[model samples]
Target: MSSPHIIVVPLPIAGHVNPLVQFSAKLVKNGMRVSFIVADYYYNRVMSAIAAEIQGEEDCHVGLQSQVKLHSIPDGLGPEDDKNDMPKLFLSTSASWPAMLEKIIQEINGSDREGKVTAMIADLHMGWALEVADKMGIKGSIFWPSSAAFLAVEFSIPNLIDQKVIDNDGVPIGRQTFQLSPSMIRMDTEHLPWNLNNDLVTRKKVFDFFFNIGRALKLTNWWLCNTSSELEPAALTLLPNLVPIGPLMTPYKKASRQHLSEEGLSCLNWLDQQPARSVIYVAFGSLTFVEYKQFQELALGLELTRKPYLWVVPSSVITSTKFSNIYPDGFNNSLRKIVGWAPQQMVLSHPTIACFVTHCGWNSIVEGLCNGVPLLCWPFVAEQFYAKTYVSDVWKIGLAFESCENGIVSGGEIKNKLEQLVSNEDMRERCSKLGEMTMKSIQGDGQSSNNISKFIQWLKE
Candidate 1:
């Protein structure tokens, strides 16, 4: 079969975009034509990036450079749009969806690209775009950005409601314990992804968002998760047509983290000074935010560890509140490494690192696992809590923090978990074994590689 032209829809968020961008390069490598639908805000930048990614290659034999195209979708953002608030940004995106759909349909019908527009690969957040493929009589698939467990839970929403574990609005039924599947972790109702615990209005909105996804996902022909089956066998097997084809990453992505080399040089030097596997590395992924008090507690907690550490507190934390003064005495004297935003993959791959104190974002977990580092799991929001369960309970590669009612993992708790994780030789050995297995799964002809090949074949068909 000849290579097919594929339309890819990506959520504008960084986590979603980063992996899909890498996947697009794979499709190009396999000699397929790709039209990546991008928000105008990032169009030129993405175009340049992807173009550079395939520059010397044949671009899947389409031409020297014509195989990949960037198509823009208005995100309802103008000079006046409020970019600070995400829900408002989401609402603005909802306003633009219909127009985006119409434009894409028109583009496909007009037929300017090569091999015909055969399929759409959309970020799961853009599940509604499946209708565009349906109207055009083409295949549609979802690129889920998080764990397969996250998708599995969304698939089981109906059962969760029927079991009286959660209401239609997704509020839990009076302190009940609910399992999305019998094999998965049993979770407290208040900690469910749709429940923010304290904010009813935002929680309801998130619930509604998932309610739409639960329906929208049924229309797609296939599910492509950014995880490997070896990592989450139960969740990967839970839903039909769910393909775990990832941790799809370039092995040398860390070598490219040179842009942050200067801010992180001192940290690297400090890591060199520590004994092997003796330092704790703390970084919450990009999107998470702890309240100022929690931030303070976390800072002090790291100090109490009395162990050398590298912590990447996003600069935004300091913007909202000055947390430095709140840190306990002797905090800076133990010596700081990576004050704000270190290159995560580099830090994880470092020999001096023992336990990763992480927010349990799927990317962070996978990276840590690939590097053979056990985690001190402190989940913040959404599927991160689910990831925490799979990490600590299911995968056994991590130790979870006991959080307070306010959802805060206090300083004392942090110190306790860090001590235990650093002291646990058995867990470190297990993490090393799992990391080796994860690497094998993504190598040539392994599960993820095979699934990706099958997905590409499906595109051609």
Candidate 2:
């Protein structure tokens, strides 16, 4: 008669943690006790968010009281550590978290009721936790935050090396375009995630990261993708035991209509004033850096289109090493509104959003797809390029911009693509249909809902 207790490990990154937090909420709703494992520096922020959610929930019996808790683990970061330095932070966590996690498991085992820990769900970014759970003799599974294709690629790193497509370090060697499946679009090897980085050390680190994931994967049995079943059939089919239980966001019916911030409110007001499906929503995921030159080109393109746009360009870009004094003159005079952080799901759900101009991060792609907006993809780094290949080529729901000779997207290319996208009725119709299908798959008795339910049942068992 004891409650089921699940330990959930989340990576410090926003994209990784947010979906897992949402997944945790869903698990709590299904009557499991949950503990969110977070990095020490992020402890206060995570606890605050959880407290807000708890305080906001209705005062019903056994209402999330003692059912959720935050467990902090040291990431080996100092007060002066630059948290934004991803590679540094990751290396720090890689050295410290495993032993920290093992100790946490022992403590919970000695203190918790009936089952010390019934199961542990780890984000794919922290795949090493799966082996830790195995060492602790508990059930474990990975909640993949990226596309199934991305995971499949990681899983096949060995095969790729054997075939001479990539080396021992995972750098593509003498690479050309290749296909993983007949239905999969041929991918340009140069655009592969690892190759994009010019820094040899950084590229090697990233390359090694995937192989580390492959090693951890051998200890885990289940992978839950953040994709709808209909979206990437080939990719899901690429690996056995990969289940589609996704578009893992807040439920549409219960989502807030309120704006996230004053800036968000202003953006919402602007969106409200536009005609339905008339404004473009542009954003690159938080981690990707956009150089000033590229940013200027993007502004020019958006201005040339003469269409209303909501652009979420982080202020970090303005302060980055790539930044220059050369600003695109007079972007404010055009039909555009730029802000820092955006309430993306709410924005995509807005009636005025026509299409998304994006870097094609998995979370953004799913959010856009769920809202039925097609895409204009300009991938920057990491799994985003794979996302671009699938969305633009396999799914036929978006367009990908090719970088010009200057390694910047020309204003002309951006303008022409935006014009072509908006005017193409067939593409629009397809987007609308795909969105409808996505909506269907995540509802009652739908494929995604069923998959998630099955996974929950497995965890409970």
Candidate 3:
């Protein structure tokens, strides 16, 4: 008779946490109880966002009094840590997660609450959650905060390795292009997601760990993807237990359309004046750092495109010590007309925005797809390369830049890709259809909504 209680643990990144929060809100609306577990460093930001949303509701007094509990766990990394040191942070977090989670479980068990934690949902990248849930004897699910297409590509690494298509260094050894079945995604050696140039020991360990984790995915009770099945039928066939429930941006939908600041608001007004589907919106996700030269090239490329554009080049991206000398002459003036720190969802959803030049981070990919905007993939590192492949090759909605001997792409290449994506009507139509299907999947009678319902029902049972 009690409401089902679930504990959700998301990766520390904003992309991961945003969807988990949205999903938790939905569960709460559906007569279940939810507990959000976040890392200490991110607790303030997450809690602040939630508070702001609650206060913005029409019945402000009642909404502000509503309680959604947040639990914090130490990330094992310090508060001021640089994100670029992710490998070190990953190891620390992995080693610490089990203990942190166990302690939280013990406290929950002792609290004598009416509805106890019946299930656990963790970010897929947070693999250590499996051990914690197993030890606690709780039902466990993994939330893949990306498209099922991306997941399919990640899952196929072992097969690529077995076929000798991907070498031990995680690079494709042959000059020929490789196409993945099901999605029919094409990939070349230059675009491989894995690092081919790292020392053999480091490269081997990274690949082995990822491969083992992919195999371990089979042990989960359910898989939740931040995409709709209609958008990626091929991925659903490959992952039977997978569920798509997303766009996962309820708060954004509920918020006022007006920008929170003068600068961002001005940008939106400017965007409104552009022709429908004619502008380019460029951003690397929150954590990407680009050398000054790369940033300059991108700026120059955008200038050459001569299209109205909005770009977010974070101060961190340009100020790194190693990349300090890489800035282009008169860089600030070149991008003076564009917006900075643009509200991503608002920008993406605008009808005037035609294309995205992106780093292909998972959340950004989902946002772009939800808006039906095509991409010009320029992935930097980690999972981005896989995402790029899905956008350009798997979906037929975007294009990839040619990489050079230094593995860097130039402004000329960026300009060419932008022109191609913006001018191609077929690509635009496909992307639009994909967007409609994606929206449908997250709503009534859609596969994603049904999957969430089923997941909750199973928890109660």
Best candidate, lDDT-wise? 2
Tens digits of lDDT, candidate 3, 1-461 = 87777888887777778778767766666566677888787887677555544433333332432445788987787667664454444556777878878888788767776356778888887877876887788888888887675566567787777888877557666765665674545556555443532565655655555566754476586878887666566667777677777767543545564425676677677787778887889888777777656667878888788777788866665466574455466555432355446767778888888898888987788788777788888888756876777787677888988967886678899888899889998997888888777777767788777887888788788
Per TM-score, the best of the predicted structures is 2
lDDT of 2 at 109: 78
Runs in model 3 with CA error above 4 Å? Answer: 49-67, 78-81, 84-86, 112-115, 153-161, 166-183, 188-199, 214-219, 247-254, 257-278, 321-327, 331-340, 403-408
lDDT of each: 0.75, 0.77, 0.72
Task: Give, for candidate 2, the lowest lDDT window spanning 10 residues.
Answer: 52-61
lDDT of 1: 0.75
TM-score-based ranking, best first?
2, 1, 3
Q: Which residues of candidate 2, in runs, are more than 4 Å off?
A: 40-66, 77-89, 106-115, 257-259, 321-326
Write the number of the candidate with greater TM-score, choosing between 1 and 3.
1
lDDT of 3 at 258: 40
Which residue window of length 10 is worst by lDDT in model 3? 56-65
**How do the residues 367-459 of candidate 2 rate in per-residue lDDT, one tens digit apiece?**
887787889898877578888877787778888887777788899999999988877778777877887888788778889889889888888
- RMSD of candidate 3 to the truth, in angstroms, is 3.9
**Candidate 1's residue-wise lDDT over 1-461, tens digit each?**
65788888877765677678778878888878788887777776576456544542232332524778777777777777544345545556666775676576576658644556878888877777776677768788988878887777667778888988888988877886666666767666656666543668866886787678855567776788888877877777677578888886655432433334366666776777899888889888767777878877888888888888888876766676665554555556445575775656667888888889888888889889888999988887767888888778887988988889987778899899889988888888898998888878767788988988988888877
